[model samples]
Structure formats: structure tokens, C-alpha cells
Target: MARAKNVLWIMCDQLRYDYLGCTGHPSLKTPNIDAMAKRGVLFTNAYVQSPICGPSRMSFYTGRYMRSHGSHWNGWPLRVGEPTLGDHLKKIGVRNVLVGKTHMAPDLEGMKMLGIPPESIIGVHVAECGFEPYERDDGLHPTGRPRPKYDEYLRQQGFEATNPWEHWANSGAADDGSLQNGWLLVHADKAARVPDEHSETPYMTRRAMDFISEAETDGTPWCLHLSYIKPHWPYIAPEPYASMYSTADMIPVIRSERERQNPHPVFGAYMDMRYSRNMARDDAREKVIPTYMGLISQIDDQMGVLMKFLEARGLLETTMIVFTSDHGDYLGDHWMGEKDLFHEQSAKIPLIIIDPSREADATRGTRSDALVEAIDLAPTFVDYFGGKVPAHILEGRSLLPLLRGPTPPDWRKVAFSEYDYAMQDVRLKLNQPIERCRLFMVFDGRWKYIHASGFRPMLYDLETDPQEFVDRGDDPDCAGIIARLQAELFDWALHPNDHITTPREKIAAYADNQLQVKGGILIGIWDEAELAAIRDKIDQRAKM
Candidate 1:
């Protein structure tokens, strides 16, 4: 039989495209990813469907949008029977294994919906990546650390790596689980010194390679989705990568007060100065840029370990290696820190695929202007396995054509990127900045239209102002462009190809669970008459 084609999907958490050398970051020392770029097709303009972690990951895992999966926010479960990349691989003759932080449905209730019994989780080959198992004593963010007593539990397992005592000896809890509290992510002075065994990258790379070796011997083609949560926060990476960038050299220009301050009321909320006061205080900005670069460099180094394993095992010639991220970080762009919305900084991600057989010398090292979306990835892999495409389940196209041809077949076509139904801020009620209810955008090489829920649409000519400082919606010259884009947006809105694919009752129940856990009703109240009309509309949709 022909060698079983294996798929090694390597994903980093919250990584931006420009943070790597391959993506033209002058200061980035991502030698591993850069080397892989030489052999694979690097997509220049790949975007995530949702800007936040959970929703973005949902689209990637399901190959469907948040509207389709019913997992719009964190804690919302991916409904039963919704196919995943793992599920698709299993559908074929492949054995699928998820070996790392599958933020999607890693807990109990979610596994129930997916028909994976608790008993089945035991004895599985799983993730061994990251600085350490974020000792989740608090049970907030998955990366949250365990109390010292928990380290005792590891010692019980004969743990000899970390001192464990000194790791969090004097670390104070600024904010248990809040990205908004940027200071909560302390300057990890110790992170740069963390050793190899404690590092998640080396651990994950070893498991992935071992898994590859075991599969090869077993005569089974495997698909392993390995997620590494690094360069996300806790900016700790071992030495070399830690020293890669200097604060003086790494600080990209921050937005000046004179720049058109609030671009889109929604977009502005993300990059707002008041929002990131903590991160910008007293040289914090300078320290942050180099640290972020350092974290990325470390991820690249660990990525090197996996690449070396592939070459040593002679699997490089047959396996498909994919590198991408759940979302991007603001990283001081527009005076922002984390990924909370649909900005160029957070929405754009590094998407590279190395299909061992296809040769693209003319395309290699060169970038493709082809507009690709996160939703396209699952279907692309599905098609790679010679599986039939389910038209109803997929809203995006595979990048195979773009890899074959550097420029998009149609230059006029644009890509779409969106944010959440309710952009949350604990400081403000979820509906407070109802500036834009829905964020939708269509942008080619030049212009972008930010469609809001209730406010005026935002138009920007990226060619004239790449920084997106000036809003062109009011400009008379761009009136023609605005009208054309509005028409396109209206058409798209009327018939969203993938809108809450699950039943209304199911979707409503999930949203209800969200309200309950959050202890706040974020949905706007339209009077009974309006709600009744909406229900009737939904009933009408059901009939259709």
C-alpha cells in the first residue's frame, strides 16, 4: 500500500502574522517557521472568522462559523453532530488524535454533547507542551497556574524538573483572570530562564514525534492537532529567543493623539487609550514589545524541534505540516495589548501549509494576495484527504488554488472578518457600546468597510493610510466606494450562508446558558411586540 499520508497540524495561541520573520517582521528570529516557509506555501492575507479566542477556534475546529456551531462565546458548547477536523479524519480511514489544549469542549459538559465518554479520555496520547501544565487551581483561564500544593502532586509523580517552590513563591495575584488587567501579566523575569523540561514546546514536540513514529509503524495514517499556548501571555521563553529583540529596536510606532482618533466606534473601543492605561504606564510599553517578540521567538524554537523530528523520521516528504494561530495580539499596535476585536492587528494571522509533494518555486518566498479565511482550512484538509466537500457545511474556499497561482484569480474579490455578537467589557454593560451591533467588513487591497450594528459605517482607504488613521465614510470621493460596499454588505446580511445552523430552540437554550453563567443579560430588549415579530420571523425562517 502507498505510505499513509499523515497530517501534523501545529497551532500556536494568539500569534500574529507579522510577528514572524516569514511575515516580514524585521526583528523576528523565527528561523524554524522561516525554514518551513521555504518548503510550503505561506498565505500572506489569511484572516480569522472571529477575533476572540473561543469563537475563532470554533470556526477553525468545525470548519463552520460561530453562527453555525452554536459556540459563540467561551463556555458555550459545540452542539452534537457538528463535524470537526478530527471527526472528518475519523470519517476517512485515519486515526485522529488531539494532543494539546483543545480549548473547544475540553471540559465535561462539552464532551457529553460530542458523545465522548469521560472514560474514553484516559490512556490517550495528549499534550506535553508549554512551560508547564498551567496548574489550574483557580479554574479560570486554562493557562492559570496551580497552587504550590498542586506542585506537590507533580512531585508525587516523581517530578524532578522545577524547583516548583520558587516558581510562584512571591508572585501576587493582581487579577485572577482578566486580560483587561494587563498588569496582571507580570513581567516574567523568570520565564526567560525556565528550562527545557518545563517548557511546553519541547514536551509537545516529543509527543507529536513519538505519535508520528508509532503511527508509521502501526500502518495507520494519522492526523494530530497539536495546540501550543505560548506567546499568549506570561511572556516567558528560554534565553536566546528571550534576548532576540531589544525594547529600543522593537517598539513599532504607537498611534499619536493627532491621528483620526476614533476610526470605527467599535474599532476605536479596542484601540482606545483609556482601555490600555495599565499596559502603557511608565515604560511598560517598551518592556512589552521585546517580551512579546521573545515569546514568539521561543515558539519558533520549539517549532524547530518538531521540524527536526520530521526530517529525522523521514516523514517530512509525506506528511502535511500546518502552522497558524487562533488569533493575533494587538502587541502595542494602536495603543492596544490583547485581541478583543476585528482590527488588522488581531484579525490577521499567519497561515502556512507545507504540502510535501506540490512544488511552487515561483510562489516560494513570494507572498500571495489571495484572500483566505479561517473557515477554509478544515475543508482544505478534508479535500486533501480526497474527501467529498459538504457544500452546506462550508462557507469558505480552500487555498489550494491560490497556492497554485500567487494572485487571486479574481482581484476584485475581498475577504471578510467579524467580531462577537456582544463585545463584552465588565466595566461597561455588554450593550453599552452598542455603537455597532454587528461588525462586518469587505476589503480588497485598498479599502475596508466596517459595518456596525447601529452606528455609521467606517470606510478606510488602506492604500493612502495603511495605519487606518482617517475615516473615509464622510469623504465625497469615496462615496462611490461606500455605496458599492454598502450594497455588498446588505446583500451579505440578508442571506448569511451560515446563520445559526442548529435549531432555534437549541441556539436559544445555549444563549440562555451563557446569560446564566455570566449573571448578566447582555441581549438588548426590544419590546414584546418587536420580540413577537422577531419570533414570527424566526418561525418563518424555520419553515424555509
Candidate 2:
């Protein structure tokens, strides 16, 4: 089959895997995303490597786990010399560009240490998480940092305000002429002060479409990362979307009394986090959930706009479209709000790949239960361009085989996710040491094991309790299962590729030399004739 010439990877921030209509959400209507799923292969068990933005996106871009990338938290730099999807794709003549947020922290310290100027082309690419920025919008600019470029654009468009990003885009005007930041629970029901078109979502969509239009004229193949920063925090939408859903439409909370009683220490810490604590209240859910749903609906509508534009431009037939999220918000699931936990609500993300190739015809509109991860996206993009995956560097396997009809026999059986809350204030307040503030999770289809440093592990049997209401980690009967899952986690922690930088041929040659030097399994004493032959061979090799 012919290769796809372009890749349109659309990523939404903090979008839940089951929020779409196709993913079995009864009330949330995501028709456009559902339609995309209908025309593609929707992975039912896709997970992120890390449940936070920067580290997760690093894994997605680098095709390596967060441990491999060494960027464990937001604002942490992806260490220098780490290869990314852009670094790999560019070798094969594909241009990868970012239209919106990557949450990539620039490696200024690394650059300084290496004496590489940050302004250099190579340095800029490394700092931007490997994509050439068509428009870099990380979205949140509350204070301390420079204002978002999108907000500046709004200011230029006659929407003048001291901080347009907050005052207009994310705030709702109070009746008494005060501005309420959308983050406040009271403003959850209020519409954004800005118009729908002027919001970050549509602005990003416009930039992506513009990039596609420009890329169509360019001769080289391209991958455009249209990363949208919506359905995220500061949950607010404009106009009709703000009033789109009522509190009655909100899905019932997924918490149970069993979860609240004797919760894991780390889990309890997350539960008491500001967002989680607030969201646990009934009043907060009543105010925030509808707005969150509205934001998602807004994203779906924007998808419709982009899809139509791509079709009109005649690019839809040749481009591969991938829709996914970095991580998912708990939305008060299991009594949590934001991600940073290994619960399905936070770790699992929606992944739909629409390969516009005839080979994918059989799998179109089908859902695959095969395990997938955020890191797989990079290798998939490389495979779509007909380039060989760099197996030595990338830990993820490509999804092309799954996207086609039959699944490979050796596909991954277990999914893994991780979170490092050491940098979070909650950990500090709890007096937990940095080294002991991390968690790792291993999950097969039916069972999950959560391993946290300096704390007892947590386990859940998904078949019996899909809501993850039970913690079986301490149960005596499940000891064997916990041990087995712990072994799995141990095996995964042993990164085989670590520190192996030599070429395979060189390593093989070294092995051969060792065997020869050691003279393994000598059958008999060398005769004078054999000694002469060996001496002659050695002399010949030395001369060469």
C-alpha cells in the first residue's frame, strides 16, 4: 500500500478516554470525535506513560517512557541529546511542526552546560520538544511568565485588557462588575467574556488549518501537531456552549464509601489536593461538570471545522489523522480531580488512528482491545512515512500492524503508567521525601497493580470492580497476584537499551573477538601444523 504523505496528529489536553459517545459515555455527546472513531481504529485500552502534561508529551514525542526521557514532571527539561519524533522524521524528509502547546520546558541549563546557544537552530528544535512551532501556545499564563501569544493576538484584535488571557478568555464578568476567574467554582456556570472564535481552541484550530494550507504547497511530507489546550482547567466556554449542558446531564460521581475508608496514604494525599478536595463537594460538581462537558463539545465542533477544511482542500484522503490526549482528568472520579494518579480516569486516554490507506479498510470503524501507550505514536508516525523504526532508541512498537486487520502475536499484554509527585507541594506538605513520592502502575486487562515508593501497593481487579473501588494490595489471598505484578513492574523498570550506545555490528564483533581470545571449547591440543596456521592467520590479521 502507498504511504500517507501527511500526518495530522490532534491532541487534546486532559480529555478523558470514555468522554466520547463511542467510548460508552451515555450523556456526553462528542459526535465529531465519534465520527472520527467510526472512520478509524479506536484503541480501547490506550494509556499514557505519565499522567502529567510535560513528561507525557515527552514520552509521546520521544517514543520513550518518561524514565527513558528523564523529564518526570512539568517544566522539567527533556535532557539534551534525546531524539524526538521530529529528529527522526526529519532524517527521512518529513517536516514536523507544532500548531499549539507542547508544554516543553527548554533545556537552558543543559544548553549552558554543553555550551550550545539556545538560539541556534538545533538548540531551538531540542527546546521545543522537536517540533518547529507554527504557533507555540502553552495556554496558561496566570502570572510570573510572559503572556501567551494568543492573548496578545486578542489584544491586537481590539479586545484590550491588562491580561486578556485571564480577564477575557478565562474569566466571567460578575453582575456587580467584578471579574471571576473561571477557576472559581462560582464562575463554572458563567460564559467566558471572550467570543467563541476568540478562545484558545478556535484560535489553535485556525492556526492548524493555516499550517495545512501552507504545507499543501510545500513539496516535503509533513506532520502537523494540532495540540488543543481545552477541556482543561480554567474550564470555561463561550456563548451557547457555556449553557449547552445542565447539571442534570453530569455523569454520576464514581466514588464509593469503600474508597474513602482507609485509603492509601499517597492516594489520600491526592484526594486532599486542592482540586480534588473542591471537586469532591456536590456543589462543585454541580457547577463545574457541565462547563467541562461544554468545553469538550466546543472541541468536537472545532474538529468538525478542521475536518471539513481538510476535506475541502483534498488533503483528507492522503493524510493520516490521529486523535488522542496526553492524559485524562479524574473529574471527581475516585474522589480525585486532576491527573497524577494511576486510576483509569487519569492514566487511560482516548486514541483513534484513521489511517487513510486501503490496508486499514478492514479495521475502520472497529475498536481494538490491544494494549497501546502514548509512546507508540512516534513510531507509528515513522512507520506511516515508510521509515524503519529506530528500535534501539524507541521503546514503543508501531501500531500500523494493529491498524490493519490482524493483531501481531507478540503485542504488549500489559499497559504501564507512572507519576512523580515529588515536586508537588502536597508531597512537601506531607513531609514525604522526593525519592519516595513516585508511583508506578502495571495493568493487564482484568487486573491492575499500583506500586508506590515508601507506601504499600494498591491493587484492583477490574473485572469484579471496574470502578476501582477496591484495593486488593493488602489482601492475603491476592498475595501471589501482587508478587507477579511486582515482578512485571521490575522487568519493565529494567530498560534494556540503557547505556548501550555502540553499534550492533561492533558489539557482535566484540563478542566474536571475546570468543576467539578465550578459545572456548577447544577440542584438542593444537598440533604443530595447526599452530603454524594460527600464527600465519594472526600475522595476516595484524598486517591488515
Candidate 3:
């Protein structure tokens, strides 16, 4: 099978797996995304290593688990020297470029200690999550940062405000011409004051197109990470998109009364949080969900625009396209608001890959139920470009085999995810120390088990309770199942993820007494014959 010349990895922030039309959303009309899915392979059981944005994105970028990468939360920097998709692709002459959000915080302390300037080529790639940033915007500049290029663009477009992102792009206009903050759920149904073309989603899409054009002009094989920060928060859409959906289009909230009464200690603390409690209210759902759907609709339209541009430029046939999300928003599912949980709503993401190779044609419009993770994309990109995946560094196996043909018999049986709630108010509510605020989740297609560091483990039989409404953590009958799942987690944790410097082959050779055996300093040799026997066993080839 031949490989595509380039990769177009389009990502959406906080988009749920089931929210797209192709993925069983009854109300949300995502025709463009659905078309992409039909032209590719869509994964049904893809999950992120972490349910929050930064850690999850770090996992995706580095092809390592969150624990392996050591970036456990938002604003935490991925340490230097970690090989990312770009680093791997660069070995095979592919450039990885970014036109949108990565949520990658630079390791300033590490850089400073190493005496590396941020503007240095290596330093810039390290700062930008191993991508050449055509335009980097995290899309949540609420206050107190240097003015962004988007704000300058809004100014050039005659939109005036101290913070145009919050004003024209994120806020709504009241009847009296007053600005209504999109942060409030009451204002969620209101349209953003800015035009649709000037909004964040469209602006980022245009940037992505511009990048592709420039990349083609430069005659370089490139991977463009066109990440959109909509369908996220400040749940306000522009113009026609804002008015596209109504409360009737919103799906029924997945929460139940049982979840509210005497919930698990950690779960109850999350439910008690302001956002979760607000999302639990019917009024908040009425105002916010429709707007969230609208934001997604806008994203879908942008996808259509991007695809059409790619086709028009004769780039579609040569570019492998991947559409996915970093993580998912809870939207009040399991009595939670934002992501940071083990629920499918928060961790399971929509993954669609359209490999332009002829070998992928047979798998087009097919669905795979393989247990996939966000970290897998890095190795997939590396493999697609004919570069060997560094197994010691990358914990994820490439998904190319799954995409092109049948799943490997040794495919993973369980998917793993984690949450570091130490930064959350839930930690304070539980009165847990920093180290004990960790939560690890393991799911083997049917049963989902959560190991909370300081509390009882949470378990759910998804075979019987697909919605995950009932928590069987305290049930004595499920003790054996919990133990088995815990063992899976333990075995996964025991993997030496940080042992990346030495190749496994080299380690094995050393273990087999193959390290410097030909040297004269043979410790076990007693006589000339003993040394002769050891030297004979060694492959003495071309010593000079």
C-alpha cells in the first residue's frame, strides 16, 4: 500500500463521540463530518489518556500516556526531550504544522536551566508541542495576557473592544445593546455579536486553509493540525448557527436522582461544584445545550469548507485526513459539567481517519470497535510516513493495521484513562492530600472500573447499565471483577514508560551477555582457555 503525501489532522475541543450525526446523534446535523466518516474509518471505542484538555492533548502529541508524559493537568508543560509526532515525522521529511490550539504550556524552567532561548528553532518546537505554529491560539483568553493576533484581526475588521474575544466573539448583545457575557448559562442561547465569518471557528478554519496553501507552495510534505476551540465553552454561536437549534433539539440530560442522593465521596464533591450543579438544572440545560449544538453545527460547516478547499487545490487525493477531539464535555452526564472524569461522555472521543492510500479503500465507511487511545495518533503518523516507531518512547501502537485491514489479534483489550483532581475544589471537599487526588480508570469493553486513590473504587457493568447510572463500587458481589480490573491497572502502571533512552533490543543483548564480551577485561575468565571460550562465543567481526 502507498502512503499519502500529507496528513490533515483536524481536531475539535470538547466534542463528544456521540454528538456527531454519523455517531448516532439524532438531532445534531453534522453532514460534513458524517461525510468524512463515510469516506474513512470511524472508531467507536476511542478514549483519551486524560479527560482534561492539557494532559489529554499532551498524551496525543507525545504518543505516551499522561503518566508517562508527566503533564498531569492544564497549564502544565510537557518536559523537553520528549519526542512528539513532529519529531518522528521530521525524520522522514514531513513537517508538522499547527494553525490552532494545542494547550501546550512551554517548559520555561527547563528551557532556562538548559540556557535555551524560546526563539531558538529547537526551543520553539518544544514550546509549540513539536509543531511549527502558523498561528497558535488556545482560544480561552479571558483576561490578563498580551493581546492576541485574533484581537488585532477583530480590530482590523472594525470590531472595537479591549478584549474582542470576550466582547464581539464570545459575548451576546442584549435588547438594550448591552454586552451579555457568554460565560453565563442565561446568555448561552444568545448569538455572539460578531459575524459568523469573524468567529473563532471560522477564523481558525481560514488560517488552516492559508497554512495548507503556503505548505504546498513551499513544496514540503506537511501535517497540519487544524484544531478548533468551539463546541467548548462560552457556549455562544454566531448568527445563523446560534439560531439553528432550539431546546427541543437538545438530548435528555443523562443525570438521575439516584446520582444526586448519597453519591460516592469524590463523585458527590464534583456534583456539588458550581458548574456541575448548574448543568444539573433543567433551566441551564435548556439554555446551554442548544447553543452547544449550534457551536458544533458551525464546526461541521467549517469542516465542509476545509474539505472543499482541499479538493479544489488537488490536495484531497494526496492528504490523509483525520478528524477527532481531544476530550469530551460531560454536559451534565453523570452529574458533571466539564471533563475530568472516567465517564464515556468525558473520555471517549470521536476518531475518524481517512487514509488516502488504496489499501484503505476497502475499509471506507466501516466502523471499528477496537480499544483505541488518543496517544495512538503519533505512532500512526510516524508509521504512515515510513518512519519506524520508537517502541521504547511511544507506548501506543500504530492504528494503521486497524485502519487498513483486520485488527491485530494481540490488540489491546482494555482502554485506560486518568484524572488528576488535585487542582479542583473536589479535592478540598474530600479533604484529600495532593497525592491522593488521583483517579485511574480501566474499561474492558463491558465493565468500567475506577480506582480512586483516597476513596472506594467505582465500578459499573456497562453490559447491564450502558448509561453508567448505577455505581456498583460498594457491591460485594462485584469484588472479584474489581480486583481483576485493578490488576489490569497495576500491570499497566508497572510498564517502564520512562525508560526511553535504551532500546529494548540493546537491553536484551546485554541480558544475553552480549555487552562488550569481546573486550580483554572479561571478569569471569580464570585462564587463557576460559577467555578463549568466551571470545569464541562472541561475534568478533571487524574490530578495526
> Highest TM-score among the candidates is held by which one?
3
> Model 2 over residues 210-285: C-alpha lDDT tens digits?
8877876666799999988888888888987999999888878999978889888888888989989988888888
Question: Higher TM-score: candidate 2 or 3?
Answer: 3
Q: Tens-digit lDDT track for model 3 on 267-384?
A: 8888888998888788888888888899999999999999999999888888889999998988878878888788889889999999988889899999999999998999998888
TM-score of 2: 0.93
lDDT of 2 at 456: 87
Off by over 4 Å in 3: 1-4, 144-147, 513-515, 528-532, 539-544
Residues 420-443 of candidate 1: C-alpha lDDT, one tens digit per residue: 555366215325554345577777
TM-score of each: 0.77, 0.93, 0.96
Local distance difference test, candidate 1: 0.64
TM-score of 3: 0.96
Could you tell me the C-alpha RMSD of candidate 1 in Å?
11.8
Model 3 per-residue lDDT at 375: 86
Give the backbone clash total of model 2. 0
Q: For this target, which candidate reaches the highest lDDT against the unseen true structure?
A: 3
